[model samples]
Target: MLVLEGVSRRFGAKSAVEGVELSIERGSFIGVIGRSGAGKSTLLRMINRLIDPTSGRIALDDVDVSALRGKELREWRARCAMIFQQFNLVGRLDVLTNVLMGRLNKVPTHRSLMRLWSDEDIAIALTALEQFDMGSFAAQRADQLSGGQQQRVAIARALVQEPEIILADEPIASLDPRNTKLVMDSLSRINRDYGITVFCNLHSLDLARAYCGRLIGMSQGRVVFDGGPFDLTEDVARQLYGLEAGDVIDMPEEMPAAVVAAQAATPPVLAAH
Candidate 1:
């Protein structure tokens, strides 16, 4: 389980997050939703230790995640992997090599610097790429792939880390509608198949409603609502997004049958826990 107690962060006079308290169980698929500047990204960054909180505590099971430093902090980051809006991949490197970078924390620094990836590690990377249906692009340069494909490579890299939690910050914000569906479906599959806790920061209400089992609504650097999809009524949504009923927009149309058929046709590629 991951617990946050009175967690808050501030930038000079500006507060990013304030007095947030949450108890997230393992294997849960949660979507953090809000308007821009609602502190959604800051919250995820704090959990991943990419940023420190100004006050309060963050704990994963028995460990005090907020106090970790140096090597311990690096290990924590490895365990709680992060995916971003921009797919962070080396442009010049082949897809396989980019995926292998996830194993850096597991290998000696010198070995990583020398790019000495073992057959076993290569196999692991390959398996991850296969899981995302990017196995055929292993030898291709990351920059050469389309946005959706590059994001899949980024996900494959995250999978190779064998993380306990995935903190995705606006992962699909830059993708087209079809690519958005593909990325979201891939994330959903990873959460379902691997039992990894997923905390996705999403701007699209429809996407959150479609994929997440639970929704956390934030407003002005504070958690305003926490409940399931059905529990988030129109009034509650208005309060969260500060929008009138007519202004609320529906997300792109979903082709459920086609998505299901595609998923069914793909060969199942299981990750090693």
Candidate 2:
């Protein structure tokens, strides 16, 4: 489990995150939705100790995280995968090698600098690419692929890390509809197949409603909403994001057949634990 206790991150004169307190259960898929500059990114960064909190604490499985540094911190970071809005793959590197970079934590820095990737690591990365339907592009340079395919390579890279927690910051912000669906589907698959705890910061409500079990809304560096999708009403969204909630969700084509089928078979809302 992940726990945040009165976590506050101050950046110079501003509080990027103010007194954040929440608990994330194992295997839960969560989405953080907010307007730009709402501090969603800062909050997620603190969870992985990417940035230090000016006050309060973060714990994973009851162990304080901010207290760790150096090797210990590196190890923790390896266990928590972070993906950015920009697919951060090496443009010059092929997709396979890009994904293999995820294994850097287990390899010597010298080997990495030398570009010495083992056959097994290469094979694992290829498998991850296959999982995301980007296997055919594995031999292509990351820059050679389209934005959607590049994002898949990024996902493959994260998979190579074998992380238990995946944190994504506006992963689909740069994609078109088809690409967004592709990326979101990959994220959904990992969350379901591996039971990895997926935490994402997104602006789209439709994607969150479709993929996440829990939604967290932040505004002015504070968490104002935490609940199931149904609880994220229009008023709540406007209060948190300052935009009409309906305006935040894009309707793609007709409603997806799979979503329609699921809605027919599944309850409209899953009860909160």
Q: Candidate 1, TM-score vs. the true structure?
A: 0.90
Considering only N, C-alpha and C atoms within 3 Å, which residue pairs clash in candidate 2? none
Candidate 1 structure quality by residue, lDDT tens digits, 139-236: 99999999999999999899899999999999998999999998999999998899999999998776776788778888889887787655556666
Model 2: per-residue lDDT, tens digit, 149-184?
889889889988999899998999989999999999
Which residue runs does candidate 1 get wrong by more than 4 Å? 244-273
- Give candidate 2's root-mean-square deviation (CA, Å): 4.2
User: Model 2 segments beyond 4 Å from truth?
Assistant: 250-273
Each prediction's TM-score against the native?
A: 0.90, 0.90
Native-to-model Cα distance after best TM-score fit, residue 125 in candidate 2, in Å: 0.7
